[model samples]
Target: MEPSDLAGMALIAAAGPEEALAFIRAGVSSSPVLEVEMTSLLSEAGTARWPGLADALGRWRPRLPSLAPERDMGVMERLGGGLLIPEDPQWPPALDDLQLNAPIALWMRGQLPRIPEQRRCIALVGSRDSTSYGANVTGELASSLVQRGFTVVSGGAYGIDANAHRGALAAAAGGGASPSTLAVMAGGLDRFYPPGNEGLLRAIAEQGALVAEVPPGTNPTRYRFLQRNRLIAALCEVTVVVEARWRSGALNTAHHAEGLSRSVGAVPGSVYSANSAGCHRLLREGAAVCVTDAAEIAELAGSAGNNLAQEPDAATALHDGLGVEDLLLLDALPLRSATSAEKLSVVAGLGMATVLAGLGRLELMGLARRATNGWQRGAV
Candidate 1:
């Protein structure tokens, strides 16, 4: 295919599989002009007719998008990160099942860790203004979940979201290939929502996946944030809420996950904290499973093998193959966990470009994973 054709495909892919298919079918059936436009492009580009047709007009159109070049790059720069089109081998197929809500393009800055095939992924969500008890409980649950090989997914907001990511990272540090954590953002990946989480968001993206449905530069509106929650509910096998007010957005996410037939889990909190009201309501309504830690979450979601344990040997081989800067960066990583590029710059005393370049190399070697917060040594 010509570059433009590929670009168009990428743009569509960024829009999510369902929407792309819907647009293509709608164009083909309702607008002869669109079909003609596509045909002309295909002919000029000398692309394979069947694959293009299948991608554009297939039954899955509602789940994908065209991902045109202009749109893709614009989204990327806006997110202050790069784009990962389906063509990128790292693209996760699990997202393809999201239908129209599936993200067409993923706005990301840090590294996307490899998710073990067929592992259970669960989302932990709660109120932005959570109580200390709620936050602490969320963190502990998150930490335990990661220890058992379940990838923890959260919104990356303050309170519960931040706690969950921290818990997962801490658990990952404990030496098993536990489930990595993921954060789905409502705003562009370039900007962290609370601003306080600028560091935390970076770490999640690097070590796991920081995903968004909107194009980069799109500041999340109330409606958009609500819409984004649906994507989170759909991506995971289950959704867990640590705390929420009566009208909390986390409840909306829980509802969406329920509608999708995904399991819903909640952590029962003290009756006094208004933040815990939502969780209590969910439990009363029979909308969620009461969970305490990673093991409980695992029992509800199942578990994966210790894939992370196998990471070190592979990382060793990969590390031995790195260039100088990469070696420097790897050396700079704290033996215990991850650190951000800015911090690494300070620790390694390297320039930003040098750090980034070295990070790219270390990422390739699988010697490190980038978290939404920063960079961390990879689980071997």
Candidate 2:
């Protein structure tokens, strides 16, 4: 096992899933390498990313020989839950898009299939203080999607998320009784957040799933809530924003979805409603396609012949593995004259850190290189 994998395993063994994920989310996690002993899987990305993780791991090592997987598995069995590490057959393939940013382990309750039916899942997201218009649209959309053999995925928060789950539960799954909806929680699945939605969440757990990256007993925190949005995006083939304010966290989920190359759709609400501003913004920015009804939303789920990504031409192949932002940054690099990161940032209209990160990726791909002066183009 890599030092990173050993580090994660040690953390899970010492802290349990909740603390382990907390340790990772502190910004310490790196792209994972697979070798599992996942009571805790520490990041190879190192302690600089996680901060105090190195010291904690040092303190936890003495107990490693005493670790008992069977005991932990028994505890999980009693809770009707289990841990999902990378090597597990049940791990969702869709999460692979997250690359180094993927969760170290998934703490799950209810049934998680051996392989996710991601094509049949669509995430419904919006503001917590959603309006009647948003709720009505989410409800009808969720109901219609469920009827069409699609599972509704959401954050399990109040407003739009709750309505999405309720609508799916209320719809008849003509195929038979099975999961028609699922909630990706920000906190531990052991406790449902917002308390007002407890009853509704319980129903979701009974019929579908309540999944989290953090282990049980972890409270729902604002940052955790924001971080969990990526999970919602990764779990589905399509993400639909029902309504959102200009600064709503739902926009984070939409961004993650787009990064994963999943389809994103935004509902159009009244232009006057501040809640709709985010959707309008996404439409204006071309981040999401405008979707009005269930059928339109379903079309975004996928097409029979169009599921595969279009093959890039040879000219575009040099840009392969580069993200949208990286491509933009690449355009700013000089061919013969190296320029500083500051110059690259202004030229690319990107932040310094983004410029540096993109440069690192480009360097690895042989599309960029560093010189005494700064950085310049490298052979593709």
Candidate 3:
């Protein structure tokens, strides 16, 4: 079929199933361009032959809208690379299973990543204000999945989502051949939401894939974000929640995934943390698999033996001879930066003299550095 015809069909599909069937029936009857065999098949699938059926279908007419090719093209251009219509070979069939809520068109900005040949993609989602435990678990699971040649998918949000992407990138950097990650956005690709993740999102677009259902110039709303979560759940083989509060939007994504017959997993978190309440609820209600690592997540998705087991000696060799005080000081350092002696003393719950002695030993051993204002942990 011609691109214009495909665009028209997509517009009707976006409108909803009933209108799409109507358009298909009308197009088949009037236009020689539409194949009779194809029309008959479509009619058998959902289109109505009798007036009763037609009346039932007519109730959905309001959902259909006129096609705007120029507007669509403009939106595509604003996104940098352009759009991917259903007619495009790169469109994944998984999304077609969404029935009515599936996107009419996709606004994309990068080369579409090749879907893994054997492994199913899984989405990891959670609260934007995730805790250190949540972020660490998200990263480990995402990295494990990537190492096993599974694509990790998530919204390009902060906290858990960002950590998931970073883990995937780390796996890719470690010589994995797969696409590793994908970021689905609520808004248009003209800009990244949260702004802080602009670099990370760009890296994803380059190494993996970044997708959106909305047109450019469209800002994300609370309603749109809820709808976007559905897409993330549907597109993946499974959805995992790393962390979520009682009011988290991540639970909505999990619900949508479960409704669609997709596997759902949740990482168990601290009982005292409000951020873990949603996950705890899911576990209690039998809505999710309790996942502790990427291996467990992959197993739940029916992709077993994909995780790379860690080499045991790697950890032992690094910390085998460390003194108690030195280990305490090391544990006090944040993953991203260093701490001052005073801050380290507070964190390690040690005296200033003890922290200073430990810092001196650590600096001499090439394990830490004294910066202009503070001490930073050095690469081991």
Candidate 4:
């Protein structure tokens, strides 16, 4: 590996994934074997050589001391995985939307399928302790997406993530094309953090791709898991939160998707379950589209999905419960011009008092309204 690549890897190892941008802003080049003079950088942080870099470096100084770039490269080689830098063809282009916070490099195993466009990728994520309802919904959505040629992306955690990967695999086995899924991990590819998911991760590495921002041999941490959510969001064109609590991390992924201006979808669940609280919150806040099936999610990929299906005409039932007098008044009311109650009475052949009462009811029901001349039909 190049010296700059090794240095960047060690920097990520020391600073964790979140600080990649900080390292770049501090005068460290991302590649071409640029040497990072930590001693001089720290020295300058204390002096005027780099005034703004002080605060950034002081907080990170203590953490940068334990890094061993050479050793980490050797570990990665032994693991048989490879690094994916931005210049590499395998690097996901959608991540560029993250700007400075985008991953400096990805440590990947297996091969990434060729994506015609980032919109063709979808992220199906939810709570780690998902319920059966969440799992079933996620599996159906993921399988449907894979069958339609979308690549599924998710964190390699338990619950919904596991089901999503399994769904994609099942679809592929049932004669779906390749490029089924990608599992972005919170830890190094060398060690799958949730040992319980070893079998699933192995299948992914064999079928799709297993990727991480952290170097080999690194352990998973709470912070890393949170940071990994952005990758899940950025790697795909749409993110679906199948089930999550009010404070679940899956919401964080959806937020990242929103920040990137990507479409967000949430599945409704039983109102009583705390597991569905986040999805409900997302819908209520207008942060996500209430998606019930794969066809709805497929619409987000620019394909003709559920949204294209003809919907019921809301106006057709706008006057369903109105009384006969009210209906008559509404029908007789002018769509563009206004008509006085006396004129409406003559047009509908009703008495003046009855016409007045019916007009009032129609107005209240939003089927008629007072116009400049008199009463007019409401925009139902």
lDDT, candidate 1, at 265 = 86
Estimate the TM-score for candidate 2: 0.64
- Highest-scoring model, lDDT: 2
Q: What TM-score should be assigned to candidate 3?
A: 0.63
Residue clash pairs of candidate 4: 4-33
Candidate ranking under TM-score, highest first, comes to 4, 2, 3, 1
Error of 4 at 11 (Å): 12
Q: What is the lDDT of candidate 4?
A: 0.78
TM-score per candidate, in order? 0.59, 0.64, 0.63, 0.68
Clashes found in each candidate (C-alpha, N, C closer than 3 A): 52, 13, 0, 1
Residue-level lDDT for 347 in candidate 2: 97
lDDT of 2 by residue, 223-311 (tens): 78877898889889999999999999999999989988899999998999999999999999999999988888877887754434344
> Can you write out model 3's per-residue Cα lDDT over 188-265, one digit (the tens) per residue?
787778699999998888788787887665687787788889888888888999999987899999999999888899
Clashes of 3: 0
Off by over 4 Å in 4: 1-51, 59-66, 113-116, 303-380
Among all windows of 10 consecutive residues in model 1, the one with the lowest summed lDDT is 306-315
Summarize candidate 4's per-residue lDDT along 65-92 as a digit string, tens digits: 5666677777777766677788778677
